[model samples]
Target: MRRLLLLPLALVTLTLMTATTSAAEKDARVYEMRVYYAPPGKLDALNARFKNHTLKMFEKHGLTNVGYFVPVDNKENKLVYFISAPSKAARDKALQAMGGDADWKKAVADSEKDGKLVSKIESRFLTVTEYSPLLKVEKGAEERVFELRTYTATKGNLGHLNDRFKNHTIALFAKHGMTNLIYWNVLAGEKGADDTLIYLLAHKSKEAAAKSFDAFRKDPDWLAARKASEEKGGGSLTAEKNGVVSEFLVPTDYSPLK
Candidate 1:
């Protein structure tokens, strides 16, 4: 009699666990990548606004602040950041509400009293790829260097590129001591939707990143995969000259994803 009762309880527990896992999978988060192009002399002001007011406003409206970064090379005076929501509809509603909040309005007006700090803003909505590892904020991740890589595929070749990564590149990266944090495709942006791949990687240090990549490039498996993909596709996946961009970043002290 006791064993019969215990069996029912165990089944109930398993059912609850399965339901929770299913819900999490169905509600997988959607991410937004935002870029603010600050005017030549106004980068500092823009950063100040975000540090002081914008991030708080975002939180109040139910957006999950991921991280904030500035490019190491500083080729353009830009601020980049990420945020997440439970779904695209939720993200849209939250942003609309944040836009109308009185506190946010006052903060924006006060920040621009001198002059408009940003010349333009660009936003991209992204959904994680099926093969992407779930993103997490590690307790000591602040000490790690993050690299954001963007790849532009040649016309009509994005699917092939993704296939290669899905089957080959990701494993090769792990073999070389690289951590694949997340992978995404641009849902909306100036760049065409079908041709872009963006992903983030974390490394212990800059030197470690270099060493890992150097090893990855020379691995026999990667070389064979690349050659076969190129041959099958009749050419390289990316455009000729400047098909890839990589930028190193450090998380801000207050960034939630660190």
Candidate 2:
């Protein structure tokens, strides 16, 4: 009689666990990366709009603000940020809602009254790579300097590059004191789907970043893995020149995913 009762309880527990797992899967978020190219002298105005009104308006439409950044080099007047929604369908619906919001429309008009702030906007949908460390919002994460790196793979070699990172490079990065935040690939962009990898890393400071990279480059394990992959894969996975772009950034005060 006791065994019969215990069997029912165990089945109930299993059913509940299955339901929770399904809910968690349904709640997984889709990330969007956006880059705004501010016109020659309008970067400050653009930033002001986001800082003052745009972000709040985004929240009103159910888009969760992730992080905001500006390139340290500043060659182009640009702003980059991330946001997430429950799913691609949800993301599209929320963005449409935000666009139709009266307050957001007014904010855009007011902010651009002087002139149009942005000239071009580039957007990409991304999914975290299978091996990527899940990003979390943590206290004191704001103090770290972030690096956004985009790599363009050599023609037909992206698979090789991904394998190297999946099997070796990611571990080497951790060994060198670099914090790997997330790795993603462009899902919808001008960049070829099979040839691009974009990722973010964090470091304690600029000096520490330089030191960490120096050590990473010299690590014997990394060197061996890189050489073997290049030889087996026909060549280096990345282009020989101008294939990698690295930008240093800092999180905005109100960024939720610091």
Candidate 3:
């Protein structure tokens, strides 16, 4: 992760900076991150085959998972996995290699030949927006944490999600140690015209993040704020009401998202 602050005057500042910097620096690899939550009832079995057993097989074949995190707030039925890639080209190279790797081929055949653990997995591919920046992460740190969340507002609910977040969620996230990287509203590559909102959260480390979130969750003020919002119009999410289905993303390569 790298650190980038998006200021009110960000456009002016960024344009001036980019104008001054050479082209080579502009192409430095920026990973587009995604996070997904597993559906309920079948997650345990799914993890055995995918996250744990299959992911190890992935690492053997070069698909390195960056990390995993779950939502402290939304805990319906979800487990998250983070994926990484150096560059788009490198991402493709790795996947191509994985496809040809005997281990991956065998694992896929043995595990999924019958059928996938879950009927379908939700996915989102995000691109790093200019206004956002990934903070440089340090290894062997006391804590390493990342929060990958999506906003899936529909034709009407989009405004509410956007405005409410602009008015509240951003500051709340910032106040609670959730730093902004980049956010993608509707990055392409999903199966439909639109159905998801994508963003990333960078933390000092997972340990520090756990503690920070524990504090955030226990705060009386935060609870009250949320309760107050619910009193207004917070029931905007429903499978049929919104007519939206979304897949969270862990950043990967060879994507159509931009």
| Cand. 3 Cα-lDDT | 0.48
Candidate 1, 109-202: lDDT as tens digits: 9999999999999988887765666676554534787899999899888888887776677666766777777788776543567898999988
Model 2 clash count equals 0
lDDT of 2 by residue, 1-258 (tens): 223224443353344334433443443577889999999989888888998998898888898888888877778998999988887788899989989989889999988888899899988887666556667655453478889998999998877887777667766666677777777766644356778888888888889999999998997878889999999888878988868888898776666655
Report the C-alpha displacement of residue 46, candidate 3, in angstroms: 3.4
Candidate 2: worst-modelled 10 consecutive residues by lDDT: 1-10
Identify the runs in model 3 with alpha carbons over 4 angstroms from their true place: 1-42, 49-53, 56-64, 70-77, 86-93, 108-116, 135-148, 152-177, 185-197, 202-258
lDDT of 3 by residue, 1-258 (tens): 123224332343344334323332342442434334445555555556664455665566555455444444445545555455655566667778878878777766676654555544455444433333333332323333445655565444544454444444444455566555444454345332154555666677556566766877776655755565544545553125534333333221211111
Candidate 1 clash pair list = none
Better of 2 and 3 by lDDT: 2
Deviation of model 1 at 27, angstroms = 6.1
Off by over 4 Å in 2: 1-28, 139-142, 188-191
